[model samples]
Target: MGIDSTEFWIAVLQIIAIDIVLGGDNAVVIALACRRLPKEQRNRVIFWGVFGAIAIRITLIFFALSLLAMPYLKIVGAVLLLWIGVKLLQPEPEGQGHEIAASTSLIAAIKTIIIADAVMSLDNVIAIAGAAKDSMGLVVFGLVVSVPIIVWGSKLVLRLMERFPLVIIVGAGLLGWIAGGMTVTDVITREWVNDNASYLRWVMPVCMAVTVVSIGKWMAARARIKPAAMIDLADNANK
Candidate 1:
């Protein structure tokens, strides 16, 4: 698709939207992984990390495009994305920051960023693949455009997450929405979804968002309760 064409621009916009939504988590991981490096070396680690992520994401996008062409794989990917969304809602484990802080070596930090990017990018790969619709040019262009955001946007995103934790919840819900959309649009299920449940193409995403938010909030509440219960037990024993 040429840059002058409407379809190309639309595809580019879709890719940009997908990358912005999905890239936040990756930015967080990169920042956290690099936080332990000396001030002088932190930027270098982040640069390499972002570079590696770009390379891996391009490769994965191509592979995902091919794999998604197969029957039923979209369903599997959708299911996995839902799981990832739910996991995103869960509170970070205590001492996780300390664990990251212990990796003081620049090499280790860069490695961490790359590995985390690879692992966390499944949703990104699938979503971008869907948006790109097998157009490699669109995929590459969109990703390249977003590279600066992924590289330098981490601090801003991190601050936003700190001040407005709801962003994380929204992000997770977005993933759930994507997962639902992906599930319905899969080649294996598309016809049935279109014929019998055409409304689901829109409805499923809303339902999935609600489901993710509700479950995540419930889990967060439970996590809070557990600590209170433990404190109460300790008070009773002390009494």
Candidate 2:
């Protein structure tokens, strides 16, 4: 856990990567929540809101790191990571809108930001905790470094996601890779895995990543079909 250690830097990079992959929606939420505020007050709201949100997130990550030490919690976390990764890979349906309420007052705006961050960052919490590997220093450093990215680099990241899309796919796969490792390292399974199936450490990442992509693509296809089917039914009724 020394700062000079390679493991430490890797954890830091992982935490920051999680932030970049997952923080765009939160930036949007902040913008929406502050839309009603005066220009002068908007920055203040974002500052305090992000500060509060980070504190809450770090606390949640701490709790998660603790929970992960229990027998089956890491397995549950791994499953959740798979679900989150698949969700990330799925395309948003057209015309989707965030129904966030804009606030006029400073306190209300901050409150809105805090609430939105808490709600939106559950997946973030788990991902960051997994990356931190119980290192509070690394968690703090990574999150602190990522704040500017979340605040200032929001538009850039969103644009990248829209243009390439492969960025998101790669990020999702990274989550699966983390989850794959987590599953084998769980307290309930770790000893057995290490003794009986050491190879799974390297193999599961590929399996989980492919599984997430395949399931996500299938769900997207099904979603597209439903809309198309509805359009066809409407056409028949018109005829």
Candidate 3:
């Protein structure tokens, strides 16, 4: 199906959301794996690792596109994306940043990131494929564009994350929007939308988005509390 400008924007936004949601775990893996290198080599390791991850992710997206074309897969993909969006709102455990070890090899660092990226990116692959549907070119284009943005944007993104957590909020909202589109595109819902015409064509997507974002924000709030709760425990110990 030919995509209009509105659909194009939606697809791009969904791809970005998928990238952000799945990117954190990859970043952590990269940081930890590369931390063992010398300061001079750290950048090199990161550069190589990111390059590998981008290549692998693009390949994986092609696989995702193929899988998404199977009958009934879009429904499954929609559900999966919804779950992923919800999961992003959950709390992640904090760890001490890894330290540099002289023995850390570049090959090992790249391996760590690639393996972790593959494992962590299932949601991203499914979610983006679902949002992009049969647009193989767009899917590929989105990944090509996003890879550098993620690599170079890391420092800026971190600063923004720290200073304005709302960026994450908006990202989650965008995921919710993607989830909405996925749900309505499901085979079962597509028939219903066709029959109803007026109600479901708009209502289903809007409702799905609202539900996801509302639940996601609530989950995020709960996640935000964990750190504060830990801080309180530390303060009490000091007292």
Candidate 4:
């Protein structure tokens, strides 16, 4: 695809959107892994780690595209994506501390960053593959654009998330929308979806977004209530 083509740009935007939405975990992993490194070596570890991650992600994107070409695999991937969206809406688990040891060794820090990135990037790989479809160039271009944001601007993104928690909610809803889109595009269901549920092309995504936000909000409220109730019970018992 030519760089000037509208389709190419659209694909690039889609990939960028997917990367940003799904990249929070990767940024967190990178930060956590590199936190223990000496200041002099942290940047080196991040650079190499992100470089390795990009290479691995490119390979995985191709592999994911091939795997998603199968009849029912898109459906499976959509379900996984939906689950991931719902999980994102929930509060992060407490006390899930990393066991990574403080290391001044550049190699050790780099290895940690790479390994963590690889493990954390499965969602990103699948999502980006779906967004890029058959366009390898779009996949590469999008990652190239997003990597700098993730590597250099993660702190900014994190601050935004903290300041406007709604961004996370919106991001989760977007993932649900993407999941809905992926579901209807499966080869096995595509014809039926087109014929019988054509409106679902748009409706499904909206519904999925709403459903994710509503369910997530409810779950988060419940979580907050439970902790408060426990504390109240403890106070009463003490009295």
Q: Estimate each model's TM-score.
A: 0.77, 0.78, 0.75, 0.78
Task: Give the local distance difference test score of model 4.
Answer: 0.73
lDDT of candidate 3 over 1-239, digit per residue (tens): 45667878767777776576466546656777878788878888787777767777777887777776666777777666666667666666344324534337877776667776676566666766766756876777567666755576566556767888776666665566666666666666667767767466556566766776788768667656444445443775786
Query: What are the per-residue Cα lDDT tens digits for candidate 1 across 109-157?
Result: 7767867888866667776665565677876776786677687777776
- The CA lDDT of each predicted structure is 0.73, 0.77, 0.67, 0.73
Which ranges in model 3 have alpha carbons more than 4 Å from their true place?
1-4, 17-21, 94-112, 223-239
Q: How many clashes show up per model?
A: 0, 0, 1, 0
- Residue-by-residue lDDT tens digits, candidate 4, 1-239: 67788867766776776677567567766777778777767777777777777777767777788898899998898888777778777775444334646655767767777776776576777777666655777667766766776676577678878888777887778777767778888889889989998998878778877887788888877666345333343775786
Task: Rank candidates by lDDT, best first.
Answer: 2, 1, 4, 3
In model 3, the number of clashes is 1
Clashing pairs in model 4, backbone N/Cα/C closer than 3 A = none
Q: Which 10-residue window of candidate 3 scores lowest in summed lDDT?
A: 94-103
The candidate 4 region of ten consecutive residues with least summed lDDT is 224-233
Q: Considering TM-score, which of the candidate structures 2 and 3 is the better prediction for this target?
A: 2
Q: Which run of 10 residues does model 2 get worst, by summed lDDT?
A: 225-234
How much does each candidate deviate from the true structure in C-alpha RMSD? Answer: 5.7, 5.7, 4.9, 5.7
Query: Which residue ranges in model 4 land beyond 4 Å of their true spot?
Result: 1-14, 96-112, 133-137, 225-239
